[model samples]
Target: MLRHQMTIVSETLMPADTAPSAAAVRSRVTVPLRFPDGYTATAEVLTFHGLADGKEHLLLALGAWEQALLDPEKLDPALPDAGPLVRLHSECLTGDVFGSQRCDCGPQLREAVEKISATGGFLLYLRQEGRGIGLYSKLDAYALQDTGLDTYEANVALGHGEDERDYTAAAQMLGALGATTVRLLTNNPDKAAQLTALGIGVTEQVPTEVHLSPANHAYLAAKRDHTAHTLDLAQPAVPSHDEMLARVDALIPRLRERAEETERIRRIPESTMEDLREAGVFRVLSPKAVGGFGMGVETYVEVVRRLGRGCPSTAWTVGHLIEHVWMLARWPRKVQDEVFADGAEPLAAATGAPVGQATKVPGGYSISGRWTFASGVMHSEWVLLAVQHGDVRLQCLVPISDVELLDVWHTAGLRGTGSNDVRAEELFVPAYRTLDWALLGAADNPGSRIHPDPIIHTPMATLLNLVAPAAALGAAEHAVEMFRERVLVRRVKNTLEDRQADSPLAQARFSHAYGLVATARLQWEEAIRVVTASYQRRPMTMTDHERAAYRLSLGLSGTASAEAVRVIMAGSGGSAHRLSNPLQRIQRDVDVLLNHPTLTLDPILEQAGRGLLGLGITVPSF
Candidate 1:
């Protein structure tokens, strides 16, 4: 059914103008193709003419591919089978041909061929190399990347759009082949959006497996952050920790820039929330079954710590929201299913002060309360509100729609957290959606039984206490860095020393601050190791002494972190104390964050002293 086009590039092999008035497609050749890895697929390679690009683009129709176009034009996703699972794979010369580890392009190509062959579809290989920026420019961008710029940043640095792809030709080719509706096999949202915009019906967006390697981690992260790509680096997929860190690292610069804006708005802006969601920050504690990363407690602390270096308010809110996922997991499986039916998604905030009261009903509880510190509520889909039910406290999970959000948070430090008041009036929460406070922190909780992942078995009470200190640690680190940079350039005002870098006092301050950061880091790591090690054991155990010790770690770390920031700020001179200076902000944030009960040194030391004397912990409920 192939036809010839009238347009000729050079001299026509057989001029369509002279002989044939035919279709745009001139050839459909079946070829048996084998790869070096012994993977084989019979490809019906196709060629088309009069393409808008005037390039010889390729199309390979895979297994039962004929059956795909054989169907009626419309796609019924509810049907047992629906496809032409098509992938409009853009060309990548270095990745596809030379086995470049810099990007996931090669793996994606190999995966697409095998997957499409199994289910039936077409792989349209468009010759838009480097995301339509050509090969030479892509390599040039790689050169820029060596200088520490991200892929997108490098592209912009090189006077090009972050992604210059245009899928108009892809749509035309699909239309020419009569594929009106297709299940798009792509991770890139732009691909689907562009195709849809160009009159092709995208029936479903089927995500691609994250083909993450050490070298391509940042490459994949850039795609996720710049464009909304569906890359869930869940377990057995990619090494989750490194991938998650890479994503967070990509966000730091942006977060630092938005620190002032975050404070001004008294909340994390909606865009920042999207950035966090895109970065997969909120999925660290959700179950893998629901498309979550299901990362461990130590990983959680590390992420929060990194986030603090950017914006402590954001870090504080995100930390609380992340912990809520674990809390959700502790509920009954039926409830967990309802909460996660969509996906392991963003911003589930919880306020745990028993400010709300719940009355036991026949099948549920009628709850009412004005809860404080409902962090991240602006971005939350669900809110876990702690309510007193008779003698015990119950965590009642309610949809965010049920609660009335009150914007009342005004503070000197961590102002962007928007830890506002949220009120629920006579809301009915089903019993299944509730978990007793006693069970939540227990190592042998329902989440452990329901989902036997080691993380599920974590003693969440301690984990909750420790999250704030991570932010403090990170802010302290940020302060150290900021002070270091300032020291090199700052002039010692009214002094003979040319710069602060030359002053002995400045040098001593820098050294002292650096040592405190190290101390804070050591303590944070030591404290968090307890969390990581707890999950690994079958029946995770932390004696009252151990719990006391954990608190001591947090207290010590928080103190060191706060002290580090103060030392840096003091030595940074009068300019450093200004409202405009980030150093002062860091000092304020670090100091305020350390005031949390878990980090307050007096009680922590007292508890540790008791533990050392074989005196039991005051709060030994877990």
Candidate 2:
């Protein structure tokens, strides 16, 4: 279904003789309507005079619908002051009366009545049977439908327009009832569009529940594909892309205020973690099967980048935590069920480079190793450790209680990451909880088959490339903003200029800084393009060339973004480096981000050079 945040259509002229007034309302009679499902309501059935379509259209006002009418001066209600909820339901006899399962019309009508009754509104039952093709033609169309033609195509085959129902009567009925504005309950855009076009003020278009059935799956699918209905037939629905970003953007101020405390304590505060949870930051990339948004890597990158502007440490920790949800999705189905049982959204932190050892046991393996730099481990309930079991390298999922933390995370930057070392001494890991490290590149892995989202097939190398760079880019962007602000106030001590903003050097530095930030974002977008394009086509394991492309583009994004921060730091006055200033923290955080094993310059450069020269890549994880 099509959703617009707000759609305001200009009111137009109607036939002067038939325009709504006291005469538009002909009569009203009280009636009690009940359904076989035990739902009951008292409705005031009303007849209208001079409607465009002379057919006997009836309007049933339920609940406090009469009390909701305004004084004709108020066009819209604000916030909690909601306008009447209305439904323009065209006549459907087969489904609504005979309980046919071939279409969702019956359930939709039931839902609309209940919802409208609860919110106080009128149900305008227009006599446009079979989408205005009449009952006989509708039955003929149904015959065509039995031959595999969809709802719309069957109508066309029967020599009728696809959908002939019009909403002129609906708008007229609302006008007669003094409901100029309404919260429309519908999944059909046509109702909203026609009503708007006919001078009805639609304050909001609220979608009705999707009444799907195994018998009518194809019918719903046709309606969704052909007419663009808002139906998530594949998986559970997630918020729209813009809505998700808005949720993250809304948290920026809070994150910025807490950045100091986060770094001072060397970990994210509990309150801050709750804020992230409320913002849905940690589930941005988790599997939809387990109640996650199941978003793609591109969305994940953009989310990480935006989060960094609030606080680099918070963004870094949250970014890893979000990616771990994606990592957990790649595990076997049994492990996924165990971890996500009882509606628990698991927060996991993983470390793989400093490999551990796993000895094969009866049903699993005994793993032992000290993995360093487990970012966000302090908040995580599970730790994914990379271990060598015999000749095969495996990723073992262990509970946080199975490990001992070594507080050795003192660093030059990103101090809030709390990337301490975790030692797991001779701990038993079930076979179901372990996956072969080599399968990280497989497109048809266990998770891919289990989760409908294709991002579950993303390679670890590709994710590693995107994760840190996204946060680095966000910090660099903040650096440029802070530098621009400082350039306005800082005056040259020895020079005659009143402010540094008047100096040619300041202008040059700001211009260069802005250009570097733009370049870094463009570079990062290239890696995103590569990752998103492949996922759309089909999830495929990245070839060496693809990894090299990602390595160069994303690696350069981090490097370029770091240079942007460096330029900002150099141009910013001495006072800018103080602990109180966020600019210095941003620089230090980005510096440590560049030192990540994946973002390090030497391997990235070598991988790019090899790909350019048509040589094999030496670094498999590049």
Candidate 3:
């Protein structure tokens, strides 16, 4: 014997000081509500009277199809056995209708509807925009918020309470629907407490996840700290780069395990290479038109540096591979299409020194000679070899099938790179595959005309000089990590109460090493910023002085990185010098990278000094 009659909750409990006079009330009518997220629910719109200012406000009883099956003739008995989910949402047109980033109201509303639609629930859509101060007043409060006033203070400045919202109508609407108990969904505990005071049973208070962004961090923080909202404000929004870097960081441990194996095999492990490929490492510098990230030099350097922190050999190989893609973009449009046709991203190995000979032919050039230090030759499909073609220095692209790999990468450091010699004996290269080396530094190139990204227009020498140093920077950072982990705990052999990290001598050494690494990073970043700025200006051009300055920075960065590792090694004990320790390997790798002809300080300094002294430009490396 269930009753269909609606209950009349205590209206006498209304605040005696500010209770409104009773007015006419209207019956609810069922209507359909739909959302862009493909959720639909039936809503019963109820208009209430006796609100303040003689204004009418609406309440909505939202439910899914299963909830609609409840018999209206026996509403009480047909009510859900468990209390329904409920949300007392104040209307925020700015956040709800427009995706404003100032607050989390919009995301909360959307989340509430989605949850309610899935389970049986009610949404008391109260028309109390700006917490009852109205829309116009809320905008005024926003101006105060911009002037250093918090949300609550801004509301108080507008002559309103921190919160002026009343839940009496919400209680009455739930009584009309025969909902005695509800699971409240809200971050504010006050909402649940208010409902309980109105005789509605709040079974559970479910805290909503706060939506945080850079724009609303302060607002959310104030609410969490000052207003007692249950929110985890400690977590900052993760940047886009962090997602990529996290993947790289996770692989560092595994890379360390395979470091010795990689060097012994004279190549990266197949599994490690697969991991890098799956993580989209090689595609970072690929043109966007061909499904590449088309990222700038800053990101390029950062990625290489992070990878180097794992294994310098792998990082060195990856750096060159990515740089080769940038080089290919300077080739003719047909070559770019052929290389990236059908969304193909081919790994390429490149060497800038014009060490090969090329003879002119009918539609291309007959190339011959050996290009040394072709890193990652085993993994690359194409080889970009610099050749002397008559009077012009040309970068000729040939398929790996046309070139033979010679295992000659046996070096003191970066041995895992397998930077073997690539020999091409009389290979015919199409004219479209050859680009003048000088054109890469100029504003307009064949690929630049078709691929409009400014990254393609970057100076070739500036980009080339960055790869080796970036790997060195990563190795330097690894050295720091190793030193901190080992030196902090190692006890001095002969001295009592003395740890390596505690010794004044060791401290001075560590500080000096850290300073050098920090200076190198700053110098590298400044050079990259300058290059990026030039690329922004169409037809990217750099004066001889600017070019020489960049070259000087590159050399200095390498020197600093190598010197930092050396300094750290000097402080590291005999244990660190063991063949099994990574510090020794890092030292060897950095030394080898620093001694590179292009990265050497003297040649770069000479070029820069001549430019500064207004001497005739003899060096073309800049």
Would you list the C-alpha lDDT of every candidate in the order shown?
A: 0.80, 0.80, 0.77
lDDT of 1 by residue, 1-622 (tens): 2222212311233223332222256588999978655799999898876667777788898988756655523333353335489998989989889878899888889999998898788999999988778899999999999898999998899899988888766766666666656889999888988877766667889888887654676778788877878886543442478888989988999899999899889889887887887677888877776667778786888899999999998899889888887778877778877886556653588887646899989899999989887877877888988899889988888899888998888887988888888988889998888888778767778877788666778776767786789999999999888888888987776999888889888889899999999998998888777766666776787777777677788889999999998888778778887788888888878777988777878878988888767888775632
Report the C-alpha lDDT of model 3 over 1-622, residue by residue, as the tens digit: 1113333222343333433333334666989877655667677677765544445567666665224324322333544444777889999999988868798898898888777666667777888899888999999999999999998899999899988888777776665555666778888888888778766777778888778654677788788877788998653332356666777787888788888888889889998987886566776767766666677777778888888888899889988888887777777778887777533247888875438999999999999998888887878888899899778898888889888888888899999999989888888998878888788556677767777666877767667778788889888988987888776888978766557888878888888988999988877777777777776775677677777767777778889999999999888878878879889999989998988875888878888888767784586766
| Candidate 1's TM-score | 0.68
Clashing pairs in 1: none
The root-mean-square deviation over C-alpha atoms between each candidate and the true structure, in angstroms, is: 15.0, 15.2, 18.2
lDDT of 2 at 476: 91
Task: State candidate 3's TM-score.
Answer: 0.61
Q: Report the number of backbone clashes for model 1.
A: 0
Worst 10 residues of 3 by lDDT: 1-10
Candidate 3 residue pairs that clash: none
If ranked by TM-score, best first, what sequence of candidates would result?
1, 2, 3
- Give the range of the ten consecutive residues with the poorest summed lDDT in model 2: 1-10
Candidates in descending lDDT order: 2, 1, 3
| Model 2 regions more than 4 Å off | 1-236
Model 2 lDDT, full chain set: 0.80
